[model samples]
Target chain A: MRFPLFLSALFLLLLPLTAGAQTKSINQFYRKYKHSEEVFNITVPGWLIKLGAGIAKSQAETPEERAAFQMVKKFKKLKFMVMEDHNLVTPRDYNRLISGVQSESFEELLSVRSDGARINFYIRDKQETIKNMLILVHEADSFIMVSAKTKLKLEEIADLVNQALDGDLDNEEIVPVIKPQA
Target chain B: MKTFKILLALLFVAVGFTAQAQDDAISKYFNKYLDDDRFTVVYISPKMFQLFDKMDLNLDDEEAEAIMSVVKDMRSLRILVSEETPKQFFDEAKKAFNTNSYEVLMTVRDKGGDNVEFFIKDDGGTVINELLLLVGGEDEFVLMSFVGNIDLNNISKLTEAFEGDGDDANDD
Candidate 1:
């Protein structure tokens, strides 16, 4: 009886690990290069972000600034890494990093390549909330990666922008209304 | 127990094959060049479209509304671009997919020796399953696949919206 109980306990303990094993996050890439001399990385926590947002909100003068603050406040965490030395990251590693993030369910939102420079945007969302947003920019001399975690929906941000653009931040009547296209 | 394990392995193999069989021709071609250093590739999956549907887009203007209507139906978008030997890649892409399976929507040849072609896979109706655009120029090659339940009418609306927006901006 004790042996069976032990087996069940072990299975329960290992179950969560197995569930998480499938996710290949950008954090793994960050952690790998964070210690490199040529790489610059910073991770801002949720509280710090909220504090910064508060300051920005207080200083905001225009509706656009307030709208930007509202959007920034929704982010739970932000991470950024940039490598100024092109030799630090190989082409193979960069490709692998892109593939790895895709494996983590990050869907490409936009990718633009021009004049030997490329910029890629990816987002991972669950239901109505965006869970993560990633941006990777590759140029001749440098590479940059930024990852943001949030529980905000794209429409919420869009609504904020729309309100700002309309110069009616207090107007709640401008909320999104879905009507069948005719 | 050994027999059960063997049966489970066979089941996994069968599942893998089924998934592979369902992949579209464009996707297969995209995957082939995905790891190539010369090309820049982008792929948006179906799950993103599901999320887009859930969003309450602020359709305050006619143009925004038209764009949102078309965006909601998009299942996936793939783009492959290269500046090196662009014409070669364009020719290779043309041969990779069966042209007979798609309807040629439009073809344009510019003064700069650039070629642009639009192909659509339809269900014998107004609904398009996939819209493929190929651009081959002296300095750039672009292959884009927009997969979705695209309505022909909405595409015209989208084009109109873009044209309306373009009028306010400088082209040169």
Candidate 2:
């Protein structure tokens, strides 16, 4: 009877810790999934794309400014790229992602790595808001993408993405709104 | 014998006229190349003469003699030039060279590859065209242009564009 009570107390104490470690549910909209080698993919949703576009337009003051703003309007942008062990993830790894995303136009952004040997990526969408952040693992047959933005809309999710990827939301150069061509 | 002396004096006058004509052509060359943006100038070594086309120079006696012979033998060529710029390569050349103004004599078009302008100094006489804008001073030349077609730009990686390990500049 005493042992069972102890076990129940321990389970109750650990539950909140586990919940705190995992991302919030609305984080599905700006997914941050990790691969074992420290390389991971992160994404933002379609709705936030429009909102970012509006903000970019409001900030511009001149023809050059407007031209710069127009240049980056395309698919979903890669948020941040980090690598584990500070090693670069090879181009071969991107094949798995490009095949799955099914977006026709894509461009690679920065590739960074963390102290723990994890790699990161910031890829932009050419045709679609990223549905997934594909994480490539060492296993030959296994791969996965964590849902970045859980279920949040633009206003709610933009903050979350900025916080999650350590992204520079204010940096129009880094995270431009990807819009369809008129 | 008196007639011979008169003939000799006339011949001397004719020689002076010929020299003056060459100088006029040189002045013309300078005007055509200067103040034009479509063309850029580069300073090259004599060793690079074989590497580029349509080079211009106010050659010394030996070089001019050799070139004259070569051109005469070739029959279809006058002189080989890569490209050229104004002779007043510096801002002060207009005043320093005693040429208050410039008059054009010859113009060499880009032939559709490298946009270069050629000019010669009127003061020096137009026996040759000097790349004016590329020269730091009267006799010195340097490469200061970063043209669009050269694959170099004002991007963040300035130093790498000149020489870097990963630099992708084509070296012939």
Candidate 3:
């Protein structure tokens, strides 16, 4: 009787941990695809974001530049992965990656279908505020996923995009994802 | 007793699976793309809007505060423009949206374009869940969606700041 009771208790204890493990995490995708030549991974640490913000701050002499950097300062940890090789990262692979990335906790923020690319944006919210934002850009030739750890507002990003278009930001490395509309 | 415990564990897993079955329809289009390179896409999340609330817009203190307050409700914004987008694609997009039962907020016929339709998914008449703007033109098309508790009045105010009396709109 005691053996059965103890076994049941152990199962109960392990259940939560196993449930947590099953949830798809971004780290898992990074680990799985990092080895493949098709996947190009870029991890920007908090320090790098801070450094980028600092450089942007120094470059801001004009009002437009200052306005643009204001948005850049909020970015913390950013991870970007792009599937470059079409043969390896086919539509099936893209769908699989998307399914793995989409979790119950993250809410759908935006999804757009453009000429060459289809972009999906998701966010994890805490206390009515966004804790993290995930962006999936699937193009004809490639699939790109950008995970940004931030509390910055959504419209501020649009403002930043608008500001970026104003010809203030010269730092290409930090702002690789912002594709201007023609 | 061991068997009973295993059965309970399996039940828990089944429940978890059932809970995650709800999928948003918009996600389906997030992987579709046309071969032509005549499309433009823009996505902005609510977090960025929250960041905007924190910024000093260099306007009058009252005006800035009011704008920020209106902006707080916006969650996300997505814009897609395509020059080579086909009519069938636009029709299919509209049909998908219709299936989701999004209510039309307004429709306008522009001299330059065929028609512009604005659709809104309202939440309890207090907040808007999603707002969709689809502009079908003769040559080009524009599709924009804003997800959140959006106030249309405030949106018009925000547009005025950028468009600035529509003086340069015709320059394009």
Candidate 4:
């Protein structure tokens, strides 16, 4: 009986440590993807994609409309809309993706837990420079940020993002992602 | 036969004159406020108006005229964009996008007049993303996009509604 009781006590003690350690692990994992080479067209949540696709289809029929319709079709087919719950996106990140980098594609896999969420925000910059990027956030006990850049090669872009995420930011509070001033 | 032809020509001329008059009235109000450099808070001239007309963002006759007028009155706007190619701007947006998606930057759209927008290309380019403006009374005067399905005809009607019934809009 004492053995079982002692085991239960130990398990409770270890649980908090695991939770704390998991948060750090998530940050580390996201940092790896930040430096990743492939452009990620991060879109998840089917509702948003459906709305975007409906609008795209309407414009595609208009001859005067620019290539915007075709671009939406391409995004619809990509992995931008895969949600895994842990990956939470921030508004600032969304603005960055649309207004900032002009890239071929962007995607994110969302994963969420009680602590926060994690997103594998990815982009594919097929051009000469790494042009596409996704800003990602994991908000829970702390807010984790992922600044992503993409290249032709997914592996190469992922590496670059990983290097960027390697900076030693003290995980104290949620820092507001500072977007480029308009 | 010659009399009939002359009468038809006169009717056509009358129509043309009436159309011109209507256009002139709206323009008169637009010009009145645009040059004030108070409501819009800027100082603009007719020369700059020609270039702003080319940007794809649709504006009705009144919205365009009103925006031009407001631009003329703005006091707190200056162009901060680097004159560069599309490629360079894309690259800059990308770097900023990766870090913060809504990174605000200015793009030089025309040689004269400040033509800028708040944009982010995130939706895989599905929709033309933009919030075109400067910081002043005239800042939100022009919405630099038509993607929201905003109708120019409706905009004109709305403009007249807000600014008071333009004679043409008042018609049955």
What residue runs in model 2 are displaced by over 4 Å at the alpha carbon? A1-33, A37-40, A76-80, A88-182, B1-172
Q: Which CAPRI category fits model 3?
A: incorrect
| Alpha carbon deviation, residue A71, candidate 3 (Å) | 11
Interface RMSD value for candidate 3, one decimal? 7.1
The DockQ for candidate 3, computed on C-alphas, is: 0.23
On residues B1-172, what C-alpha lDDT tens digit does candidate 1 reach at each position?
9999999999999988875554467878888877576887777767767667766656566677898898899988888989999999888877765456677889899999999988888879989988999999999999999999999899899898888777845552
RMSD of 4: 27.0
Residues A29-118, candidate 3: write the lDDT tens digits. Answer: 667777787667888997888888889888879666776667666777888887776624556656665676564366665556665567
The window of 10 residues in a row where model 1 chain A has the poorest summed lDDT is A16-25
Best candidate, TM-score-wise?
1
Task: Give each model's whole-structure lDDT.
Answer: 0.80, 0.36, 0.66, 0.37
Candidate 3 residue A8 Cα shift, in angstroms, is 11
Which rank order by lDDT, best down to worst? Answer: 1, 3, 4, 2
Ranking of models by DockQ: 1, 3, 4, 2
lDDT of 3 at B36: 35
Instruction: Give the alpha carbon lDDT tens digit for every residue of B4-99 in model 4.
Output: 999999999999997666434323333443323222212222322322332233233444455544433222221212222433433433343233
Per-candidate TM vs. native?
0.73, 0.20, 0.49, 0.21
Which lDDT value does model 3 have at B8?
Answer: 100
DockQ values of all predictions = 0.24, 0.01, 0.23, 0.01
How close to the true structure is residue B18 of candidate 3, measured as C-alpha lDDT? Answer: 54
